[model samples]
Target chain A: MLAALPNPQGVSVCPRRARWQLDLLLLALECVDLHASELMLQVLRELQLQGMIPNRVVFWQIRCTNPFRQVTQRTPLPLAETKALTAVVVQVARRQTAILRHLLLVLDQLQAQNLPPETYAPLAAYLDRFRRNFRKRMNLQRSSLFLYKNHQALNELGLKLLAQLLLCAGTKGMERLWFSLFDGEVS
Target chain B: MLLQRQYSLPNCTLRIEGLSGQAGAEQLDIVTCCEWEIIGQNQRIKGGKDFLVALLNSVPAAAQTWLSGVKLRRSPQYPIQVEIAAANQVSLHIPRKLLQTSPEENSESPTNDEAGETLEVHLTWLQLADLVEALDQFCSDSQTLPTLIPTFHSLPRRAIAPAVPLRKQLMPLGIGAASLAAMAAIFFHFPVPERRPPREEALPPTPEAVTPAPAPTTPNPPNP
Candidate 1:
C-alpha cells in the first residue's frame, strides 16, 4: 500500500540516472576513439622492422578500437565515408601487423644470440605481462565496441614499457644508425 | 688553416694529417693518420717511407686482415694512410683537398698544414666499417662529386687551433686561482660586523596612547 502511493507525484516515470548512464557510455566511447587514433604502434613497428629497436617490442593491437564504430558514434556519415575509413584502417592495421611479425622474427634471432641476462630478462617479463593483460582486457566483455574503453591506460602502459626497453637495450649508436638509414631510405 | 681530422674510437684516438709542407720533400699526395703521442714511448717515424710502419705493427691480426682489403695506392690521386703508433692506438693520414688532381697539380696547392681542412669523426668499430664502405663508394665514383674544389675554401679558419705559449696558457689560470683564493679569504677572514640588538635610542616611538580611528560616516544613504 505504501509503494502504491508513489504514483500520486508521477515523477518516477522518467529515470534521470539512466540518461546520465548513457552519456557516460558515450563519453567513454569517444575517449577510446580519440586515444586509438593517436596510437603509436604503427610508428613503433616501422622502427622495429628497420632494426632500430634492440629489445623485444610488442603492441597488442595496432588499432585498438573498431574503426567503423568509432566513425559512426556521433556524427551522421555517408555509408561511403564510413566504408572508406574502415578500409584505410584495415589496410594500415594489416601492414603494421606484418611489420610486427617481421620484428618478432628479428627478436627471435636476437634471443638466439644468447644476449646477457641484463638484456634478456626485462624484455621477457615485459612481453609476458603485456600479452597477458592485453588479452584479458580485450576479452573481458563479449561486446566488440565497448572493449576499447580502457585504451588510455593501455597507451600509458605501452609508453612506460618502451622507455624501460630503451633503458635495458643500451642502444645509443644503434638507433642513430637506424635513423640515418631510414632518412636515406625515405629520401 | 690546416684542418686536422681527429677520429675517436672506444679505446684510442685517430689523428689524420695531410702532407704538411714540412712532412715530406714533395707534397706526396698522401694524408697521414697517427695516434696521439704517448708519455714515455718512442716517437714514430716522421718520414714518408715508413709513416705507417708503427701503426701497422700494432693492430690485431684480424684488423690487419681487414686493412688488406683496403687497397693502399702507391701514388693515389689522394690516399689515406692508416697507422697504429702504440697499443690500442690508430693513426690515419688522409690526403685532403686533392679531390682528383694529379700529384703535380696537387703540389700547386699549399701543404696540408696551410690550406687543407680536417674532418674529425668519433665512432665505434661498426661505424668505422660503415664509414670505410661509404668512403670506398665515394672514391669509386669521384666524378659524381659536385663543388669539389670550392668546398674546402668555404671552411672557416676557426677550425684550426691558434698557437698559444705555455706561459700564456698558465697565466690566466694562475690569475683566476689567486682571485678565487683572495675572494675566499675575504669571505672567511674578513671581520663580520656583529649584529647588535636595536638600541632604545634608535627605536621609533610606539603609539601606546593611540586609539582606533572612528568609522567614517557615509554622506550617501545605503541603497535599499
Candidate 2:
C-alpha cells in the first residue's frame, strides 16, 4: 500500500506514472538561474507590495544546475521569508478547498473587483511562461499540492485554477489597457 | 630523449579520443592536426592525418594560430614543411630559430617508444615566451560572462488527452463504452483458434465390436 504512493522527495521532478501523458502537453520552462531562493522571494515580495496576491499560498520547486540530480534542501530559506512567497502564489489563486464556504464568494469577488485583463497581460504572460518551463513534482495524489502526504487527490483542481488565474490575468491586462486607451470601463 | 631534444623535435600528437553524443560517450583520440580538423568538422577519415598536422602546425606561429583559436604574428621569411611519415604520424621540420632549449633543471629524461623515438619537449622555453605577451595584449577585454547562448528544448506540461477516472457520475457510461470496445477489439483481433464449433468435439465416435462367436464355433467343430 505504501509502495503505491509516490516517494514524497523523489529525485524525479515529475512522477514516473504520469510521464507519458504529461510530456505531451506543451509547458514552458521557468528556469531561475540564481542558486539562492531569495531571488524568487524578492519577486513575491514585490508582487505583495502591489497587492497582486494574498500572503498565504504554497510554493514548491526543485533546485539544481542539473535538475536530473536530486533536490535536497541545500540552502534553507527562513520560514518567515518563505511565507511571503507562498502568499504571492495564493494571492492570484485563493480558492483553496479548505476555504470552501467562501469559495463562491471569492469567485464573485474575482469576477467583480479584479483588474480587467488588459492591465496585467505582460506579467501574466511571463508567469505563464515560467509555469510552462521545468517539470513540477505534480503529485497527482492530491490536487491541492499539500506539503504533507495523506492528502486526497482531486479531479484536476488547483492546476486548472492556477492556469486559469494566469490566463485571466493576461487577458484582463489586455482588456484593461485597450479599454483605458478609449477611456472605457470594463463591463 | 636528450638526443631528440638536442636535435629539436616534438613527439606528442593531438587526436580525437571520442565523439560527444554517442550512447557510450565520447573517446578522445590523440590525432594529427589535419585529422583533428576533419574530425572537428565531423567528416570521417582514418589513420595518421592527426599527428602530422599536430607536429607540423606547431612549427610556426601563423600555422599554430590557424589550428588554435589564438591570434599570432610571425616572420613570413622562412616557411617550414610539415609531413606525415612511414608510421602514419606527422613530422614537423622547423628552420632552427623556432626551436629553443629550456634550462633542463629539475627535469627527468624523456621516455622512448619501441621505434627508438623519444618524447620531445614539444614547445621549448623561448618558443613559449611570446604566448604570455600575446594573451595579455589580446584577451584583455573579454566579457564578464562566457557569453550565454540560448538553448531550445521540448518539454510538455499536461496530457494531450484528459486523465482517466473522470467524475463519479460519468463512470458507468464510461465503463460500459470501454468494455464494449475492448470486447469488439478482442473479437476482431482473434477469431476462434482451431475449433469453430464448440459442441461437435464433445464426445468421441464409438468403435464396432469384432465377431468372435463365428470363430469360436468353427474351432469347436474342428476339435469334435
Candidate 3:
C-alpha cells in the first residue's frame, strides 16, 4: 500500500518544481487538443473532483503558479489543487493513450527515416502549436525560456514534454506523477 | 451458491467466483475464487479474496516505474504474491495451500510434504493489460465491493530513489570518457587493415565509355 500524502486539505504549499511539471504537462495536453481546458473541466466533473478545482477561473489560478508564465501568480499552489490538476492530467492522458501512442510511433519512424518532423502533418501541427503556445504564454526573459527562443529548440522541448505526458498516462500514472513532483523537494 | 464473473479479452481471461457476503441489497458480492488465464501459454493462477485484493492494490502503482518489478502481497496469512518476473512478463505465485492434490499421487505432482511451494504463472504485458482492464471493470461495478474503489497514493519518500548530487551523477560520465580516451589511444597504436587494389571486374563502367543498351522487342511485336 502507498503512503497517504501529508495534507489532504489545501493547507500545505506544493513544491515549485511540482508546479512547473504540472503546468508543462498541462501545456502538452493543450498541444494535443485545442479544447483541453474544457476537456479538463469535464473530466474534473466526471471524477467528482470539482470541489478542489471548482471552475475554470480557479483552474487558471492554480496553473499560474508556473514561474515561466507571462502572468504568474505569486501565491504558492496548494497541495489539494496540485492533486486535482494531476488527477485531471492523468485522466486526460489516459483517454488520449491511443493518439499519444500513435504520435510517438510516428515520431520514432520519422527519427528513423531522418525525416523532418513537419513531414507528418499531425505531428508537425502539434509541435507548431506547442511552440506558439509556449511563446505566447511564457515570459521569454526568463533564463530557461530565453534558451528556447528558436523554433527548433522549442519544438524539441515540446516533443520531450509530449513523451513525458505519455509516461504519465501509463499504469499508476497518477502516483508516478505525484511522486515525481516531489522528486528533489523531499530530500 | 457461488456466483462467477469473468472478463474476457482476445488473449486473456480473468474469472472471479465468490458468494454474496452479508452485503446489503446494493453491495457487491464477496470474492472467493479468482483465476487468471492467458491463452497459448501455460500460465494460470487460482486464488481467492487475498489475490484479488493484492492485484487491485498493486496494479495502480505497478505501472508507475515503467512496469518495473512489483511484489503484491496482502499479508502472511494470504500466501499468494504477484510480481513482475521479467520485462513484458508478470508472474503470480500461488501458495501450495491453494493447489489441489490429484487422487493418484504422481511424482510430478506437488505432494503435501512439499511445504512452502508455490505455482507460478507468467503472463506477457499484453495479457497483463487485459487483466488490468478487467480489474478496472470489476472495480467500476457498483455492486462490487463499494469500499474497493481504486485510489492513487503518493509513494513514500523512502520508496523513491534519493536524488544524487550533480557531481556523483557526473562521475560515471567522466569515467566513461577517460576509458574511451584510453581505448582510442590503444586503438591508434594498432595497424589498420591493408588496402587492396580494386579489381577491373568490380569497377563500374565509366560514363563516357558506357553505351546505352538497346530496348528489347516483345516476342510478339505489335503490328506497326
* TM-scores, each model vs. reference: 0.18, 0.16, 0.49
Q: Is candidate 1 or 2 superior in TM-score?
A: 1
Worst 10 residues of 3 chain B by lDDT: B67-76
Query: Candidate 3: misplaced stretches above 4 Å?
Result: A1-6, A9-11, A37-64, A67-74, A87-187, B7-13, B22-30, B37-50, B64-133, B146-152, B165-224
Residue A152 error, candidate 3, Å:
13
lDDT of 2 by residue, B122-167 (tens): 2212122122122122222122111222111111222112243347
Chain A TM-score values, per prediction: 0.22, 0.23, 0.92
Q: What is the lDDT of residue A95 in candidate 1?
A: 32
User: Against the true structure, what is model 3's DockQ?
Assistant: 0.05
Q: What is the interface RMSD of each candidate, in Å?
A: 18.5, 29.5, 6.6
Candidate 2's DockQ: 0.01
**Which 10-residue window in model 3 chain A sums to the lowest lDDT?**
A1-10
Model 3, range B77-96, lDDT digits (tens) per residue?
33545554332345655555
lDDT of 1 by residue, A47-152 (tens): 3432322222211111223222222122232222222222223323333333323333334345357542124443444344553445443343435425434644
Per-residue C-alpha lDDT of model 3 across residues A2-100, encoded as one tens digit per residue = 233345323367877677778888998988888887899999999787777788998898899898899998898877777788888888988887777
Write the number of the candidate with greater lDDT, choosing between 2 and 3: 3
Best-matching candidate per TM-score: 3
